[model samples]
Target: MEAPPLERKLAAILAADVEGYSRLMNGDEEQTLATLTSHRTIVDALIENAHGQIFGTAGDSVLAEFPSIVHAFNSAVAIQQAMWRANQELPEDRRMNFRIGINVGDVLVKNGDIFGDGVNIAARLEGLADVGGICVSRGVRDHLRDRVDATFEDLGEHSIKNIARPLRVFRVIFDPEGDPAIDLAASPVESPETSSFVEQSLSQDRDSDDEGHRVELAFWESVQEGDDPAEYLLYLERFPNGQFVELANARLESGGTGEHDPGIELAFWETVREAGNSEMLEAYLAKYPQGQFSDLANIMLGELRGS
Candidate 1:
């Protein structure tokens, strides 16, 4: 009665979505839909020609599985270039650009549909990419390194929902004229460091705390800012029983606020300048218990008590 179990295989998955689909539809629904339909037609054909299969598609997104990393990368480049050429004739406001993300991992295929952390990570990476740009997982990058004629920039590791480990990322830069220049393999990218505020706080803590604890705090701050939380999680795996392990776990649970958000930052500044109250500080501390700006939270709380 039940369907057969899906087959599992190692595949390079490419996820792509239109960057501003909603905006385009809102501006001109009829034309936008027409363009999307035409674009999909072209893309579907290209994918088939490149030895890839289109297993899924949503409103403005597509998911394809390729047997080879090189084929996946080549298909993606072809799709982007074709779309770019098509958009050239359209008005700037009428253009529909896409963002793509690729990952190579084992996935389950059922009824031609793919499912796994591999698919989820690929979609999330697509969200992180710029319009008309491509972001690929480290696995995909490494697989395609020898075959592609594109340069890749390390974007560091990132955490993705439903994935147990951080996925390192690289942005592919397509050069129409120049040959690909391979750089000697380097160490993985580290997390970004906190600004002066965190540094000053750590400096003060250093004078009073044990050297080991100071080092731990430094590492924690780096993880918070420098690298993607997903990547930082990978670090934790390596140092499973390390000091600050509990703290790291807590931050991961809380989803530390490190990524840029103008709205949240503005609200935080407003709370400090206007309320100057413990209620505000408590709220922030609760939301970001081990936040890189925890010292700032302490200072605000102190001011609230007139200390």
Candidate 2:
């Protein structure tokens, strides 16, 4: 028998699954089912509002498609923010956090269901995401460049299970107050209040920059102690002929700073920013108590922990 011709098209797939669904269900199936039902209603409504179609679903999971990658990205952010708000009303133990992943690629459609590496990648990406977090493939990330207002932390590349090539993955930094795409019909006119705010923000940036230039801070501040040879090494690695090079070299030659393996602070910062859970902040603080961005890290830790 000859099989029917396959129907395929480009698509943006969003795959989401409840984090720790098995544990939640095992603890109380009835309650979990009840809460999931209510959540599904909210989720489906939001997806539809964003022009996304629910193509498939399994227990504690959802599969949706959006024609536009930007909208998909927006919807994913909105869903996580919505879920966070919804979870707040429930007891902490019963709250359900969903991990969402999005990807854009060619897809095969049959009987209203979608199947392809695109869908598969989305699912795998979902697994890579933190509970209540979102992950997107490089395709989606590239599409998001200017279409949406969001921040993504590059988590580097990964070799997917059963996939021949490695994939670049990025984690969307969760924003409590999610930003949705503006309506196409909305006027491009900038209102007085918005214009004022924008102007003020720019003014502040200019002022901050002036202050920053006087100090030439951040990276230099970390190595200022000049007590760690690795720190000097790091500075040298970053700036071979910097003003501090002479000092760094002199310090090194003088049987310099203790070899305390001055950590790769940039990479660590990236990991902290890509944190899937609040615990990463704690780990970061413990390791880099006096490191750069500790203040920001503390603030972020508090936000994630208290949220």
On lDDT, the leading prediction is 2
Candidate 1 per-residue lDDT over residues 1-307, each given as its tens digit: 9987889899889999998899999999977875676567556656765778888888999999988888788878877876675666567998888899998888998876899977888899898887888999988888778787788999998887777888788999995223112110111123446445666668877555555544544565567555466856865886676554554555565565533443343344334334344554565565556443344455446544753
Please give, for residues 179-265, the per-residue lDDT of candidate 2 as tens digits.
Answer: 333221122336799988988889958767555433433455567454677787887888775444555676566555423323244
**TM-score versus the correct structure, for each prediction:** 0.56, 0.58
Clashes of 2: 0
Each model's lDDT comes to 0.69, 0.72
Measured on C-alpha atoms, candidate 2 has an lDDT of 0.72
Q: List the residue pairs that clash in candidate 2.
A: none
Candidate 1 wrongly placed segments (more than 4 Å): 176-307
Which runs in model 2 stand beyond 4 Å of their true positions? 1-5, 179-307
Q: For candidate 1, report its TM-score.
A: 0.56
**Weakest ten-residue segment in model 2 by summed lDDT:** 179-188
C-alpha RMSD values across all candidates: 23.7, 21.2
lDDT of 1: 0.69
